[model samples]
Target: MTHTWALVNLKPGVGKSTTAVFAAQAAYEEGLKPLLVDADDGRSCLAAYNRADGFKWPVIGLAEPDLHRKLPDLDGGVDLVIIDVPQVEDHARIARGALRYADTWIVPVAPSHYEVDRMFEPPRGAADDSGRYRLLEFFEEVQDMRRSPADVVVSLNRTNRAKRTKTGPDAEVREALEDKGFEVLNTVIPWHDDRFRQAILPRTPGTNMRRLVRELLDRKGATQ
Candidate 1:
């Protein structure tokens, strides 16, 4: 069975693409044949795959709004599928389509007041059926459609080391999210040097990403 995971967020630069790539890499290291689907029209994930010299997995760009339908066709014989979804604010249709088929929805959130504030607001002028609505509605509609709630978790990404103190942004964001009844993962991706941003080389999974992969697998195992 193919375990499909979607990395989604309402705002940009939240490390969605980076998380997708690193997660795929971690899955690969774990002896899983991971397929990366770049569902974002920006094609950032696909571009990263293109630039990498020795990336072993198959990465395809399916930026169309009908990704839910097309994704299954591409999943044959794969152990895992990691989807890099577009920002919900701009690509609601595509994001909605991806959510319909996703088994796990991973939300990457930066520890910032603005990003956290944007999480609760629906996209302006968005229809109720759009991805923006699904995001703001906290996947309630998608859950209703599937007859069960999706496995969703928030990953705190690009955290500053100094801000990890009790009263810093990381703690504040985690508290706020927990107060809102969201599950925030303990594994955090810290703000690294420029080398972390460059995806041209085959990346060895970082400690944070390895922990994230383990958490994801552990959750999937417990659910099973």
Candidate 2:
């Protein structure tokens, strides 16, 4: 994991696992040895590899807090150790442990208040799906309070083409994330059907995601 990177941060459906897994697939195509570590016990990354038969590289699976100690031991053998973390509250402890060790992190934002509200862990009931959708109004609020900022290039995920307006949540979220001092990526991962299919059936990333993965690998010099 010498040239390894971790996709940490305790936020589910934020594309942490999606980014980590696809990044591994992309790195594999480039001939870099990347290890996929499922730092979270649930929806584990290693298990997905076994199921996807997508292990173009080796994978390590561990429960909470183990990754913090395991990272040092595994660092020398691989080009990257990409770990997928769980959402906050559910695995905040594990998330903290992995973040403590991540060299670079890929964070996903959906541009909604519910998604953005992960920053402070809003009053449990105040944040429902509808409340989150209202994030456009509080864009400034999201940018002002980042709990764990890092050498992180935040990427927008699950963006819809037919947005409520025209630019969409992805565009809005990217602006807010950048304003918050994050290094945002240029590639936009458009919502696609096949990518989700590949996720369930176990195959290489489709064309669009593969290209994005290649860019990330190239940026990190993990490319051949």
Candidate 3:
């Protein structure tokens, strides 16, 4: 069976597309036929695929409400499907649609007050709120709709190495997430422009990306 993983979050610029690309590449290197679905309306994943010379796998754009129904049918022989979803606050329908079919939900969060606060926002307005509250509600709805708890794995991205000490932002963010009952991954992707700038290039990812992939695979194994 194809294991589908969705890169989702309530905020943008959290490295969702980059993580999706790297995760799919890692899966490919692991002998899994990975199919990357650019479910974000921004089409950043598809753009990355276009910019990368000689990229081997298929990266398709399908940001629609019926993504859950259509994605599995397009799996072909793919062993894994990595979906780059839009920011949950902006495209709840598309994100929720992808969530319904995803086996694992990987949330990429930057260690910042803005991003961390958005993660735990409460549901406030109508169904059309489209804010962080609505985003949280969508996740709950997906759990009920699928009749199973969502397997959510949080990753701290764009971390600053200089401040990785006990009182640093990275540690604080991890503590906050854990306090809220979130399972934050130990592998933190540090903030490095050189590596991130080469995201669209057909080159090997940095150590953090590789470690993130390994952590994800290990988590999947443990869950199974």
Candidate 3 lDDT: 0.80
lDDT of 1 by residue, 95-130 (tens): 888888888999899888778876766546776445
lDDT scores in order: 0.80, 0.61, 0.80
Candidate 3 per-residue lDDT over residues 1-224, each given as its tens digit: 67888999887888899888877787777677889999887888888887875367899999997788999799979888899999887888898889998978988998887788767666655443444454566777888888567688788888886234477778888888787667888888787777675656644445667777777777778777
Stretches of candidate 1 above 4 Å error?
A: 122-134, 162-167
- Error at 42, model 1, angstroms: 0.6
Global lDDT for candidate 2?
Answer: 0.61
lDDT of 2 by residue, 1-224 (tens): 25546665445667777777777777777677778878776766765677867665777777567566778787676777777877655775676666666656676765665665564343345655434332222222322333433346666666664232236566676666666566766765666656653565434545545666666666666533
TM-score of 2: 0.72
Clashes of each: 0, 6, 0
User: Model 2 Cα displacement at 6 (Å)?
Assistant: 2.3
Local lDDT at 56 for model 2: 58
User: Looking at model 1, which ten-residue stretch has the lowest summed lDDT?
Assistant: 127-136
- Model 1 accuracy (lDDT, Cα): 0.80
